[model samples]
Target: MNFKSLKTLAVNGKQVIVRVDFNVPIKDGRVIDPSRIQAALPTINFLCEQKCRIILLTHLGKPKATHDPACSLQPVFEYLAAILPGVKFAPIVPGTAEAITRSQEVRPGDILLFDNLRFHTGESENDLDFAKNLAALGEIYINEAFSVCHRKAASVSTLPTLLPSAAGFQLQKEVEFLQKIMEKPQRPFIGIIGGAKISTKLPVIRALLEKVDYLLLGGALANTILKAQGIAVGKSLIEESMVSEVKDLNLVTNKLRVPIDVVMAPSVEPDALSQTVAVANVPDEQRILDIGPETLELYKMILQTAKTVVWNGPMGYFELPQFEQGTKQLAEIIAGLNAETVAGGGETLEAINQLKLNDKFTFLSTGGGAMLAFLEGKPLPGLEPLTIE
Candidate 1:
């Protein structure tokens, strides 16, 4: 918690390099969701008011150090121009002479949008010389990409040390919310966790066991848990390897809540077939794609009186229309609940949007990996540099 606030520093006429997470979903060369961009605006607007020459740095989809035109941030610049009127933005790819020249063109109140930093391998590698080259572009570094803070990328972890660094408003807010849920959430606190694998969410599940009154499992993660408990989950996605680990948790504590029934199908196609059945009755060749009505009602009942709730991952194979019911129903439940509910992760965000329930929650996070890391008390390489300690 020792990180300096963006407000504590003088930004007047100084060049400020803001590392923002603009890895938004795009389709046909257009940004489909502008929420991530909108999240960074408060920090950007504050910098604008301070009359600082701004340089916006971010990565799109991973290119793994290879330059791919498909992963360009050009659409983002276009989206920004539409939102922030009167702001001049010059787009340039960093690690080039042209980028340096473009940086010179940025005046007070103007921004230089650096293209996908992943185009150069140094970004992912956290190369020192690359960090120095990036630091040369500005006098101050503001780590605004809380979504990517768990990584040790050049701009995220390295540049912060090479320049005067601080957390942006979005990062600060994310940290506060993480603390709110993990450190001081009100009871009866409940957590609804889902997704494709138990391996990824194991630490988070273990962490929640200590704090939440009930830790509900769903999706493939639930299937694995069921398998551990010696339940027959037929043709469902279950991690046979993680079953032993899940089994071991039985000895640790008793917060793990499980589903009683699930929606099943022989094939997960759009219109093949589906049926809601008890967990003990899953057919041999059928897959458990969604939670059954009984399980859905069970969740609603538990969430009805929750004083605080944190949910990550979708409740089922929410991408397929046939299996989206559980996740959507959970979203609706969280939306209507009179509780301090915080929901996040990529699939969970998609579920919230698909159900059009964004504003209904108390907080929506931009970070996925970073959120889990913070909740599990793991070291976040990017945020560590800014920590006052």
Candidate 2:
């Protein structure tokens, strides 16, 4: 909350480097989703209004500190050019003299986008020398990539220290909404957590368990919890290593709600025969694919009285039509609520977008791991240097 805001900075006519999250899904050299890119428009437009030479720095999919053509930002640049005419692409390697030269050539009111930052060796390593070289590209740094705030990558954490830094509109908005959920959510706050693994979400789950009035569990994650409590999960996905850790969380709390019934199937195939069964009656040959109608009804009843709701992940394998009901119905239920609803993570947003209920939520975060880390009360390295010390 103490971070400097982009609007408060004196950035007139300056070459400003804006770290944005344009890491949208790309297939066959075309962007599949432009939501992440769209989320950053407000910040980019504000810099344009100031006549700043806007230089964009971002990473696509992980290139593992090596140059990968598949991870190139060319497709993204093409997509951006169509929306904002005259936006230039600096195809040169980052942290190089050529890159710096391209930066210097950018005129005020022009936007220049660099290739993948991860294409450089020092990017993921958080090398200060790399950051110093990058700093020469601009006079100020504005972080608009809230989704990458949890990382300690060079562009995220180190480069900010080399220049006057501030949080962009999108980052500021993300922080404000998440902070409200963590600090002082309205009473009757309900949190719904689902997904495939407990390993990644345990911290957030533990944190929410202490804060939320009710915490609902579903998906493969619930399977692990159910198995830990001596219930038969059959061949369902369960993290054996995490069962002990889950048991230590003391599942006796009235706030924690696990599924009582689930839809089971032999496999996730489209033609797999499936049926709804009580949690205790899961067949030895079957796996839980989605929450059953009884469980959905139970969750709906609890959500009705919520004053605030935070959801991450989906209730089931919603990619298939048959298994999509639980997640679809959950979205409809939450959207119909009058409460403040906040949802995040890739799968969760995909489900919401599929249901066409995006505008219904109070906020849909672009972050997945970053949102979880923020909600877990963990300090994000990328955010630390941006703080007003």
Candidate 3:
């Protein structure tokens, strides 16, 4: 995973295109969360220090290869402009004459943020022409978007090949930290995996089992494992298709820990009558929503002894107040531990952000799918061109 480093690159007074992940949550024409934008500041600021004319490229939401105003990066630009100096906006279509003109107009030590890259049809298609056109705007390409590094898109995979490419500071740091966890983690390494789908997390689960000393499960992912062992999950959500796959994993082991009790209710409504019950006592019509207090205590005991902890996803449907206790409590327990803690994924970070415990962890990765893929021992497409062959 060796790659060219941006800090060592010679980019004085040159136009540098940086692919950043500004895919933040926008609400009512405003950027709701700016963590992703803030994460790229170190790289952007470093380029500014090097007197580089920076052209920023990012996709806001899924535009689906159309010109959708709702998926525009205008809100992110506005947010960035207020906090950063010498920042300008290029609201024209990417890879067009207007875009080239705007990019050329960028002065040294200034940033010119382009409109949504996903607005163009070729960005997601990994089209060479689109990448070549994008490469024309700058002499160097820096990928600061680790969150989208797993994607094989034109901007991420193809554009890097068209220019002198390097890994940005954020991307470099992400790879280093994740690589440490995978290759040389401290003894007593613990992994906590949760979320709604077993299909998405199965590979990482299997990969972690080979490395981690203990693997704890929660959320709907645990329900499937419980069901595969002939345990009744009531009306809980479980992937029926993955049951056979789960059974093949040999769940009757000591390393993997499933929930012993859960918080269940007839419905997921906030006011729904919820009760904590042992795994074997769930009613036929009740749905499991969160891990119970007993299960939390068990997880806490295991976490207290961890020398290193890697967590992805939440312990429950943390969006709801009643079901948020398990995730919140676990986060607090981990925060108080004397361990090298790392957590990632969209929902996991959201829960951490809501808990205001970001500073407590050793590292909070901006990547979700990329983090999982790296942990699963898979090669990332966006990182391929930057690799120092």
Candidate 4:
């Protein structure tokens, strides 16, 4: 974590290779959300100011060695050129020796973007030869891709072994921002953790239990908790083994709030039969899909009182319009908060955007698995190798 940032690196005459997360959503060959590209702008702009020769590297979509046209980075190159007209694109096809030779021609203040790394088998496999070839392109390396920091790939995990590496502004910011919560946060640090499975989120929930003053559980996991308490959860999904853990954690009490009522449906589809029922008295044939209004009110009060709040995942099946009300309300509550609010995960971001509250939070992390892995006190391979000196 003691890696040198852009501030410590001299870029006036150096060929700087920056690893950024430009894996944005694409539809009809158009970039839908430019948030990931925008997140790396501070570093991009800074390096430009320093007159550094910029070599941008990123993976677009999952592409095999045969090169799928749909996974090409050509559209990304076009989008970036529009965002930064001064930065010229120098294409480097992955796996080709020509890539290194092409990189040799890069001049100071010029910007080059390499093609999709996944198109080359070595990139994903962490081939040493490929790493050395990539390292030869730059005098220094800057990792700004927090979203892919958890992966131990050739570019992110191995390239640093051959060249001096540093953390970019975006990576440093994400570390510093999350570090605040790792340390003892302000009093009433409420945490809301939700998603579909108890098995998947068990580690996060266990970790938060030791720190958070209040923990709110919802979504499919809430049904499991309710079922464990001997309450009728109906046709909702339940993890039978988690009942003991839920009981041991004392989640039945006020410290960890589960829904008192839930919005139930026969199926997850929008056209399914739906109704709301008390959690304790759910019908045997109905499947609970979302938290009821009463639960939203309880969660809102906790949000209002929190000085620092960290949230991940959706409170309900937010993709469905009928079940979106609870998640939407939660986003509204988060939007109105004056506290330091940090949200992560794909569903959480979607709910925030749907509620038109993306700008309201203190920070919206671009990472998903990387964020959760970091929160669990695990090391990120892409970030661990970078040194401050």
Question: Which pairs clash inside model 4?
Answer: 4-388
CA deviation > 4 Å runs, candidate 1: 86-92, 251-254
Instruction: Residues 1-389, candidate 2: write the lDDT tens digits.
Output: 68798989999889999999998888899987788899999999988989999999998888854678889899999999999966998887778889998888898789999998888878888999999989999999999998999988889999998999999998989998899888999979999999999999999999998899999998899888898888999999999999988876666867999998999999999999889999899988999999999999999999999999999988999988878899999999999999999999888888888778999999999999999999999999989988887
Models sorted by lDDT, best on top: 2, 3, 1, 4
Query: Using Cα atoms with residue i matched to residue i, what is each candidate's TM-score against the true structure?
Result: 0.95, 0.96, 0.96, 0.90
Candidate No. with top lDDT: 2
In model 4, where do residues sit more than 4 Å from their true spots?
64-66, 87-95, 228-247, 281-285, 387-389
Model 3, span 1-389: residue lDDT tens: 78899977898888999999999988899987788899999999988988999999998888855678898888988999899999988887778778887777778878998899989888888889898899889999999999998999999999998888899998999999999888999979999999999999999999999999999999999999899899999999999999988997665777899899999999888798889999889989999999999999999999999999999988888888889998888889998999999999878888888889999999999999999999999999998888888
Query: Which residue ranges in model 2 land beyond 4 Å of their true spot?
Result: none
Positional deviation of residue 338's Cα in model 3 after best superposition, in angstroms: 0.4
Worst 10-residue lDDT window for candidate 3 reads 245-254
For each of the candidates, give the backbone clash count. Answer: 2, 0, 0, 1
Give the backbone clash total of model 1: 2
Cα lDDT, all candidates: 0.86, 0.91, 0.90, 0.82
Better of 1 and 3 by TM-score: 3
TM-score of model 3 relative to the true fold?
Answer: 0.96
Q: Model 4, 1-389: lDDT tens per residue? A: 46677787666778899999888888899887777899899999988888888889899878755577888777788898787856665555654689888888887767888888887888889999888888888898889998898898998899877787788888888888887786868878988878888877778787887788998888888777777778888888888888777665675467788887888888888698778878887888888888999989878877889888888878788778889888888888888988989988777877786667888999998887788777877788887787543
